[model samples]
Target: MLSQPFNPLPLDELTAVFARIKDLLLTQDKVDRALEVLVQAVGDAIPGSAGAGISLFDAHGRGSSIAATALVVEQADAAQHDLGQGPCLAAWTAGTTVLIHDAATDARWPLWSEAVASLPVRSLVSTPLAAAGGPIGTLKVYASLPAAYTSATGQLLEKFAVPAATLLAHIQGPGTPRHLSGPLKGALAGRDTTNRACGMLMERDGLTAEQAFHELLRRARTSGAPLSRVCSDLVDGRA
Candidate 1:
């Protein structure tokens, strides 16, 4: 969609949209909420986008789903995890936007295309969620039909990228840790899996928390295993 001839946008209009974002951020409860707004803003900025979602990576290189407008985010996440390729992954890895106006015909990620075809999706665009250290994740947009997103839309998404990163940084700060579920709930947050694995290792081997964690990592590297798998093995007494 972005293949068309370029047309310049006026500065006043750009500043106006940014000012509105500033106002929304001020009223938001936290950085995550602000990022939701930022994702929605990307949709509003683009003409054909039906929805948007944001994901962020932790210190462990694991990316978690944050906020999403619909099931498209879930599909996108699955595609990235399963196929290990897609706009979102590329955006995060390269710290740059990856825009694909048509997924069905795209050769970049054939497995991703086949997997996502069943979903009500077509065009997709991803902008790197970056900070001082580099990319943490992606801000992804989805359209219901092919060739819907344009280069202009990609640029607009880029404009909001910094603010999205800032909000994510705030949410993932010293005070807030990423949890998959709430405290009252049995759901695990960011370090929950790691904690559980450490506990299991400790119980099985009489090691300290730090020692167990290091052991898990050491075994994972030595055995060429995934940390999550090592954790599971410890939990299930299979390691």
Candidate 2:
């Protein structure tokens, strides 16, 4: 099933999810720190949130450069990636928003919810980072209270994700993201192989870059496998 959908929050009603980037303009090395600031700002603005997090998904749907406001929040996000199921990944794949109003009773992701039950994340709302290419990641908020997030909260998150995705795309260009922790380094290492596979598809099928990417996304989702693996198979002529 697709996730819940909503209109963007009005400009005047928007909050500080994208805090001032005064420090961001200074250096590229601070990109991760700036993302942390954004994540913290969103959590702070929420009334009953335990924390907030932003995750950029790689080919495997795992989070990279994940920034969370609290340790439990980080643990909960890690559980989602480790288990390969959760609101964030669901939202990203479906290109919609997911709200686990109460994780205790939410059966949509039984394994993910059960895995993080020991943590302080009783509720969660995550919105997709819908970019021009497709869903590249997600931004999520966690709360210790059941039903902590409402439609209004979901709308606010959608607003936050708009610019968050844009900022992430810009910083991921060549020569940027020199230090995005370590996950990004791994993604970068696989960039060449992915590009080669994409190029092969593009030339062989007359597909544009975006179309080639969508085809790869289709294959990855179909095989229930990582994008990296899908690309490798294609480059190795196994698919």
Q: What is the lDDT of residue 170 in candidate 2?
A: 58
lDDT of 2 by residue, 107-150 (tens): 87789888988877787899987655567778999988787788
* Model 1 poorest ten-residue lDDT run: 180-189
Candidate 1, 1-239: lDDT as tens digits: 44444343454655565566666556643545555556666676666667888876553435667778777777777677555556686676545788887788898777788888888778888888766555667888898878877777788777767666665554533434345222202112224555567777677789865456557667877888776677777777686
In candidate 1, which residue pairs get closer than 3 Å at backbone N, Cα or C atoms, i.e. clash?
A: 2-151, 178-190, 179-189, 180-188, 180-189
lDDT of 1 at 90: 62
**TM-score for all predictions?**
0.65, 0.71
How close is each model in CA RMSD to the real structure?
9.8, 7.2
Residue pairs with clashing backbones, model 2: none
Question: In model 2, how large is the Cα lDDT of residue 233?
Answer: 96
Candidate 1 has an lDDT of 0.65
Q: Top model by lDDT, which number?
A: 2
| C-alpha local distance difference test of each model | 0.65, 0.73
